[model samples]
Target: MKKIKLSFDKFKDSTIYLNSSKSESNRLLIIKALSEKEITIKNLSKANDSVLLKNLLESENLVVWDAQDAGTSFRFLTSFLAIKKEHVVLSGTERMKQRPVKVLVDALNKIGAEILYLENEGFPPIYVKGKINQVKNKLDIPGDISSQYISSLILIAPLLEKGIEINIEEPFYSRPYVNMTLNLMNSFGIKSAVKGNKISIKNQEFSSGSYIVESDWSAASYWYSILSISDNINNLTLQGLKKKSNQGDSVISELMKSFGVNTQYKEDGIVLTKIKLDTEEIELDFRDCPDLAQTILVVAAYHKIKLKVSGVESLKIKETDRLVAMKNELKKIGCDFYEEGNYWILEKRRREIDDELSIDTYKDHRMAMAFAPLASKKSMIINDPDVVVKSYPTYWEDLKKVGFIIT
Candidate 1:
């Protein structure tokens, strides 16, 4: 395993430009393939996840698509391949195989797509034989599981022969991502309507046009963590972000304000500056933006802010068991973190910070990036720092520009 040691440095005023949103890029790739007319996408993400999805979609003789722990790729591609006329196998890394796909598989199977698990039940390494017979046009799926599964089915909804009507059960997690999918489909000339828990899309052909992906708000969360815990009078600018974004993680700007970080939107991007801390205790429900949970948790721990978090039960099935990973790793840095029922609480303890706390990434990109911001407060070594390539490939490089010493 490879590790990168990061140490605190004097806060520097720097402007860091971020890559395009991988979430938007992956959806656009799928929509582009479904469109009969020519479509162009600009500012696509350089993240390995987007790159892998793009490559796999463009491949001519693809027998096997190895997503390699890119969950979005696996879920989105699973639906994309389910409606095609070819036979393909979708598999991924060891960890990806452990992530559950049965919910999405059963949903697709209910709609007439043929997909069978090759190894374990409710997991990946599945064989897909695309021949949609249109058994059912309506699907009812539990929204608490993963929004990617919902987005996957909806993105291909217009392509289905009979179209599709989806009823996402209550207690939906990551609702904004589902909205992003529908909005992206709308941009491509497929109109969808969401009434309460029901989303309806008719059998319409996608229109070709140009789309420019916004900057990744999820990637920006780490910078928010860095600014939130930095020393006095710190100001950092992030480029290519919008005040209004389809991405749900844009809520980070408001959430970080609780941690003494303020945002000022400029024409090009936004600037984050340290401000007065508002509350002693913070309670957040990440049902719509679970990706920001780790960044928030780490910052709250560093500041010793009492935090109560809920709506993260899905974290157990992410790239790794994130909730358990947080419990183990945060303890190494002098914090007591645990889960009670549906809530995960973090309360700082009076313990000395380790001289050199080491964090294990567990092959999860968010874990690596989320904890890297902690180096702004203390010296730490992040094992498998390269894991960030899954979404934010330029994470460490951007950290260096903001005055973090990585060696």
Candidate 2:
């Protein structure tokens, strides 16, 4: 396995410009294609996952697409290709195959899609023979599972003979992501309405227009973490982000405030400034913004703050079991981490942290980047550092710009 050692000479005041949101970019790409209208998209994400989605959508005469570890691309394409009336196979990396797609496939099949599992009953490597007839327009899907499935189906809803109505069962997670999908759909002239647990989309046409994606708030979490744990107050500017964003991860700004990071909205983007720490114990519910959980946990661990986190049940099904990964990895840094029922707790250990800790990424991009901020406190080695390319391709480079030495 390839690894990189990161150490900081000194934390410097710097301005970092983040790439566009991959979440928004991927959704727009699908809407643009479904519209069959010529639309110009500006400031698309440079992440490998978004790039792969774009390439797959533009490619012709392709039989199979290996989505690697991009769960969004895999799920989004599964529905997108199902409605295209083509014979294609969608597969992914080894770990990706372990991620379940049965819920999505079953729903698509009920809607007249021909999707068969090539290997496991509830996993990847599925054969998608496009459906010619619409059998069902209404679906009952569990809300606790991945929201990508719902977004995938909803993105193709307009193309169906009769638009889709999805009844999301109670205990919903990532509601903001579903809202993000609907909001993006609205931006393209497709209208959707949500009443209680049901979301209804009509068979309307998408309008052709120019879309400019906002900067990724998820990617900015690491920077917020860096500022949270820094000893010296630093002024950091992140460009292209908005005070009001469709992305759900925008909650990072408020969450980081407890850790002493204050945010100011500027004309171009937002600026981060370190302030006084006010809380000794922090508690967060991550149901709507699960992506920020890891970064917040790492910050809490480093700052020796008692943290209680809930609504992270979905972490088990991500690119890796993030809760388990964080529990195992944080132990190496002398942290007491455990989960009780729906709540996970992190506390500092009596023992001193190891001088040179080696973190295993578990093939999860968030794992690699979330723990990277710890290097500002102590030098550490990260295994499979390239995993960050899946979401933030320029991660290491961006860290380098702020005086992180990677070798």
Candidate 3:
């Protein structure tokens, strides 16, 4: 196992070039495929997700796409293939196989796709028999499930002979994700509408177009965490983030205000400055933005702040059981993460940092990257550092740009 040990006494000011958003890049790849027109995308994500999307689009005949733990690839391609009606076996890493795809499979079945669960129900390695004609326009898909399923269907909606209308049952989670899909669709000359838990897209061919991917807002949250705990915030300038971003994790700008990070909008990106504020206990429903859970939890624990979090049931199905990972690791740093009915509370009982904070990444990229920012407070080692290739391939390099020494 390859491990990267990060030492941080204090970091100096330096300019960092962050990777572009894999989410946007993948969505655009599907759009371009539908458009069947050649276009140039600038600053595309170098992460594995974008790489898989690019490769799969170019490959033909008996393709075994090693998604390498890219969830977006597993899902977006699943729907993309259903539209093209190509016979392919979609599989990923062992951990990816464990991630449930039953929701998407069932939805695709309703739309007339021949899909069989290869190994087990609700898991990967599904044999998809693609190319079924006559996908109905109106359908009921669960809203509380992974938004990837919804995004998958929406990406192909415009191509269907009958435009698709999705009726979302129950309160939707990851709403920002659905909105991000719509925003990207619009950029590619397609539009969608949401009215009372229903999203409708009219039948229209996607236009071939070039798209510029913004820096990942999810990646920026780590810097927000470091700035929240660091004494000097004047040095951190996160570039390529937009004030108006489709990424839902941009809520970090508003949520981190309570943690003492003042946000400033710039033409290039946003600047985070430390401010004077009395930290207090807070509560939020993260159902709309589950990806932000780890960054917020680490920031809360490192600051010794009390926090109540909800809408985290999806954490169990992510790259790792994030709730369990956080609970176990936070205990090493003298913090207690416990569940109370529908809420999980982070109680900071002590200020003592473990002399050498050792972390297990559990093959989850976020686990390694999210916790690494805490090293700004103390020295730490992250196991399985390469796991970050799932999203931010340059994560460790970007940290080094900010004066973090990795050995």
Q: Write candidate 1's Cα lDDT for 346-372 as tens digits.
A: 987557668678999888999999888
lDDT of 3 by residue, 1-407 (tens): 88877876456664555678877888878787777666668888888878877988878675565666778888987877777846678888898998999888888778777887779898988777767575556788887768889999999988887878889888789988888999988887888888988999988866676778899888888888877876644557888999999989899899888888888999999888888767878898999889999999988888788999998988998888899999998888889999999899999748688756899988888999888977876788899999898889888887876777899
Alpha-carbon local distance difference test for all models: 0.89, 0.89, 0.83
Off by over 4 Å in 3: none
TM-scores, in order shown?
0.97, 0.97, 0.96
Question: What's the residue-level lDDT of 54 in candidate 3?
Answer: 91
Ranking by TM-score: 1, 2, 3
lDDT of 1: 0.89
Model 1: colliding residue pairs: none
lDDT of 2 at 135: 84
Query: What's the CA RMSD for each of the models?
Result: 1.2, 1.3, 1.6
State the displacement of the C-alpha of residue 1, model 2, in Å, after optimal TM-score superposition: 2.1
